[model samples]
Target chain A: MSQPSDIIQVSNPTQTSTKSALKGGYNPSLGPIQLPTSYQAQLASTASSKRNIYDHSLSRRAPEVNLSSLSYIFNVMIQYSQKNSKGIQELEGKLNTLGYSIGPKVLELITLREGKNAKREIKLVEILQFIHTQVWRTLFGRVADELEKSSEADDEYMITDKQPLMSEFISVPKDMGQLNVNAFVAGIIEGILDVCYFQASVSAHTVETPGCPNRTVFFIKFDRDVIERENLRFHK
Target chain B: MSKSLKTTGEDLWKNKADKVNSELFTLTYGSIVAQLVRDYKQDYTQVNLQLEKMGYDIGIRIIEEFLAKSQVGRCQSFKETSEILSKIAFKYFLNITPRVENFSTDGKQFSLILDENPLAEFVELPDDEKANKQLWYSNVLVGVLRGALEMVQLDVEVAFVGDVLRGDDATEIRLKLIKILKDEIPAGED
Candidate 1:
C-alpha cells in the first residue's frame, strides 16, 4: 500500500501504548468493520507520533484548505447518512459514528499542538477544557463560546458554540424536524470523552438566541460510574 | 452570441457562492480524500470510484440548491445543458468556468477542460507508480455531472479524460448524453 506523505511520524512509546489499548478496548462486535492491516499500521504509527508535531515542523507544513470543499463534502455526507437512517435519531446516530472516527485523531493532534510531551489528561474538567478550547480551535478555527454546568443534573455539562462550522452551510428542510446537523459535532465530543475513559452521551440542541441563527448547545451527560469515579479521584 | 450571456450568468452565480469558507472547504475535502485513500489501502481505483459515488450523492441534492440560487430554467436541449453546467453550475460552486470543447458530430458529447481545479489547490501526489497510473484526483466531478444530469432527465455518462495531477498535460472530464428522460405522468393523468 502506498503511504500518504502528509501522515505525521510519531515515535512516542506512551502514545502508541495508549493507542494500542484504545484499539484493544474497541468492541469489535459493535460493527463488522476491520480496517485494512496496512491502514491500521499507518494509524498506529500515526497515533504513536507526538501530538501536533506536524504543525511545528516548518519543513513539511500541513495542508491548508478552503471550508467550502469541506462544507460541500459534509453536506453530501449528511445527505448520504439520511438515506439509510430510519428517523432523525437514527440519522443523528449515523452522523455521530462518522464524527466518532475523527475524534481520537483530532484529540491527539490538538494536544500535541498545545505543548511538548503533554501528559494524558485524567481529570474530568481538564479533558473538558481540552475539548472546549484545543479541539474546537483545531477543527473550527475558534474556541467554543461557553462551557457551563447544568443546575438540575450534577453530571450534565453544556458546551455552546455561537456558530458551528458544520451547520454553517446547512439549511435543514422544515419537514425534517429538529435535525441539528451538529449531532456530528456531539459525536466527536462523545468519541473524545469515550477514548479518555470518561463515558458520556453528547447531543446537540439548537438553542437559538435572537441574533445568532446557528447557536448550538451540546449537552454532555456523563455515566453515573464516571461521576462516581471522578468523586473518588477528587477525594484522593 | 450565447458565450457573453454565459459569462454574465457565471458572474451572477459566483457572487452567491462566495459566502463559503474556501480554506475550510479545501482542507475538509483534502482530509476526506486522504482518509479514503487510507481506508482503501492506497487502492486508487477504489478511492476514485468511491469519490465518484460520493460526488453523485452530492450532485443530486446540490442541483436543487443550484436551481434555487441560479433560478435557471430547463434547458431546451443537451447542448444548452452542457452550457449551463460549464457556465453556471461550475462557476456557482467552485468559481471555475471550464472550457467546453471537443463536441461529437451528433452534438451529444462534449469535453470540459478544467484549467483550474480548486479541489486540487494544494494536492501533490505521493511518488509512487500506482498513484500515477490509477488515481484520478478529481474523479468526483465525473459522478457529479452524471448524477446532476440524471436528475434533469438527461441520462448522461461522465469520465475523466485526463488529469494534470496524474501527469496529464491538461485536466478534462468528458460527458455524453445518452437520452432525455420523458416526464412521467401519474396513472390518471395520461
Candidate 2:
C-alpha cells in the first residue's frame, strides 16, 4: 500500500497540502496567519448555514440512481480489494466491512420511507418478512426467491435468491476455492439485523441449480439469546 | 415526429434491459464516494483522480460487455462515434441520452452536455469555498470515456469542464480527440 503522503504527492504535482489549504494558509513564502477561536467558530457556523441554504432548493431527495454505474463502481471496488488481498476469505472480509458501513444507513432510510403509519417491526417473523419483501424489493427490484427456516435447527433461517444481483456479472475462477463474493451482501444483511437489535450471523453460499449460474443462498443464524427471547415473546 | 422518435428510442432501450432498483444503486455510489472522501482525507483533487482511475479500470471491461450486448460495430468516423456514444451507449446503460454539442470545425473536439446525470442524481458539493471550487463530482465519466475510447483505438482527452452540483449552468464534459491509434499486428501472425 502506498503511504498517504506518497499518494498526495503523486496526486498533486503542485504539492499543495490539504491541511494547509483547510487552514487557509496555503503559501510557501510566508507563515500562516492565526485566526482567533471566535472568528473560526463564526466561519464554521456560516459555512454550515450556507450549505443548508444551498441544499434547500436544489438536489432532489430522490434516491434513485443508474444501476449500470453502481455495478461498474462495485466491480472497481472488488478489483481494488483483490489486488491488496492474500486470499478469497480476506477479500470477502474486506467487502463485508465495506457493506457493513452502508447497511445501517440504508436500513434507516428505507424503514423511514416504508410506511407513514406503520410501526417499527417488533416480532422476529415480522422483521424477517420486512427483509424478505420490502428491503429485498427496494434493493433488488424483486422479492427474494424464498425464505425458509432450517428443519434441523430452529435458530437457522435462509434467504435464497435464484440470481443474486451483486454476483450477476461476477465469474469466480476455478482455482479460487469456493469464493462467494455475496458475503458482502451477507454483511449488509447482518448490519441491518444488528441495527434492529437482532444479533445474527449471515453467510452467503452458492447453490447450484439447473440453468441458474448465480444462485445464492444466504443462511442467517440468530444468536441463542435472540432465539430464547423470540420463543418467550411468541410463546413458541 | 420528434415525440414519436423519442418514444421509439426509449421503447427500444426499455425492451433491451432489466431495471434494477435505483435505491441500491444510489446507496452503493454514495458509499463509494464516501469511502473515497475518507481515503483521500477530503482532498477533492486526489478524490477526483482516484475516481477517474477506478473508472478507467471499469471502462475497459464494460466496453467488452457493451460490444457483446449492443449491435455496434467499429465506428466509421468520429461523428458516428459520438452519435453512438450519446444515443446508444448512454441510452442503453443510463437511460438518458446526453446531447453532443459545440463540435470543433475539425470535428476532433466536442462537449457532451448531460441534462440528466445519474451519477450526480443526489450529489451536492459542500458549501466550503475550496471544495466547491475544486471538486469535480463526476470526474469518473471523463475517465470512463477516455478508457473505453482508447480500447476502440481512439486516443482522447476527456474532462469535466462544468458541473451543476458546483453551481455551474449545466453539467458538461469536454472531449478532444488526440488521434486514432492504428492496430498493431502480432509479430508471428503478420
* Candidate 1 docking DockQ: 0.15
What overall lDDT goes with each candidate model?
Answer: 0.75, 0.75
- Residues B78-179 of candidate 2 have per-residue lDDT tens digits of 887887788777777777788989999999999899988777665655546767688887787888888999889999999999877776777899999999
lDDT, candidate 2, at A235: 85
Per-residue accuracy of model 1 over B151-171 as CA lDDT, tens digit each: 888899899988876657778
Clashes of each: 17, 0
- Looking at model 2 chain B, which ten-residue stretch has the lowest summed lDDT? B1-10
Q: What shift in Å separates residue B120 of candidate 2 from its native position after superposition?
A: 2.7
Top TM-score model: 2
Q: How high is each candidate's TM-score?
A: 0.59, 0.78
Per-residue accuracy of model 2 over A1-236 as CA lDDT, tens digit each: 44433432323422433333233332343345344455456446645433322244322345333456667877887876787689988888777777777788778767666557546777778888888887788788789999999999989999999998887878889997588888878888888898888889888889999998889998999999999998998886
> What lDDT score is found at residue B183 in candidate 1?
78
